[model samples]
Target: MAIAVISGCAPLIQLDSDAQPSTVNQVELGQGSGRMKNEQPLAHLYISDYDSAAVQNARMSGMKLPGYKPEPVVTVNHYVQSLMHDLAANLEILSTTFSVGVTSFVYLDGDYQQGDLLGNQLSEAFMHEATQFGMAVTDFKTTDYIRVTPTGDFTFSRDFLELTQQYPISVVLGGTLVRHQGGVIVNARMVNVMDKKVLASAQAFIPQNVVHALKGTHSAPLLQLKASQP
Candidate 1:
């Protein structure tokens, strides 16, 4: 049997909580700018970028791309699962509860050239597995103020933010993914988009074997993510 490895939800955001948060061995919350709105404090996560020397090498080494091959599916699955898991744990540490939101662009497939044709399917798969691990999406959305493209860097410019009216977003989450020294590194960050302030951040390193292996199904270790305060 095969499960749908997709990411998707209605335009409307929703969140369900099971506990008060902060469990033993939980990630610690750091200081952040108190710019989040009281009502709709949302964190919209976007795919920062996937272009890296290591990823290129992996592709050259035939790491895997979107195809019928199980290897590609597994590789893409692991990347989304682990990164979102760490991103959730790290973000919750700072605020009592954060509504998680992801953009349609996060799952980008660069036609097998430089990026993963990563889409809602991949995100859905990741979300399903991430729930078993830890990550949670409370509820969130982006505002008309900004438009985040798949640029190498997160841009905060008037060209995008100015074409808006009321900005409903609380934060924008994004970061980098790269392979180094046979290991893959994932970084996640929550920023107060309107205030130009960083609320929380997390960085983690995954083992090469763990990340590169694509034959068997493997669960992502709830490895501790290095969190940074504002």
Candidate 2:
């Protein structure tokens, strides 16, 4: 009786096998499996030969997506370190024994007396790097008196009136920034204060993108205006 029961289901299994392919094809091809406009089978879509042309076209287009090309990872600190490293390599008489000071980098075309935020930041970064390189850097911006206020306790000031007129700096490290189309060229040098002689010099090019990455809080009038509108 069990053998007879198994034999009865053999024809039903064969019928299901024949219908399975047709049902799958109908679902994949969407309603009309053989009457579609393109009439290409699903297997043909996965063929390498059919996709070769598309792959070649994409290659020939030369499309550059953002972050596609590998760029050298860098920061303001890295650039400052590079400049200091070069300066160290080219030092004449400057060493750890000499007390050094860092001034803000100024624009090459400007009067050289005033500097911007970027220049101030570059000077600060150079100070940190100089200390790491074993140079004794003097903080001339520190005041003899600390101003204690409700907001915070302040010991540093840029005002010449607050700071002492003289510091024990033997060497001063300074730089100039020249803006170009692609980026800015930084020219850095260590100078003797008394004799006014250049001790060591170095230069590095900072890409505009990297420079723009420096973050700060500032007012954006255009953005404010847009936000105020409908």
Best by lDDT: 2
Candidate 2, pairs of clashing residues:
none
Off by over 4 Å in 1: 1-98, 103-114, 117-168, 214-230
Q: All models: lDDT?
A: 0.40, 0.67
Deviation of model 2 at 198, angstroms: 0.9
TM-score per candidate, chains pooled:
0.32, 0.63
* Separate clash counts for every candidate: 13, 0
- Write candidate 1's Cα lDDT for 1-230 as tens digits: 11111122211112122322121011112355112223433344322113233323434655432221222333555566666666556654644344334322231222322322223333344446534544344223223344556764332332443444443445555554554565656555666666767665666565655553433225433222344578
lDDT of 2 by residue, 5-115 (tens): 011111101112233223312211234432323354333232232234432333365532112233356877788988999998898654788899999999899878888
Backbone clashes counted, model 1: 13
lDDT for model 1, please. 0.40
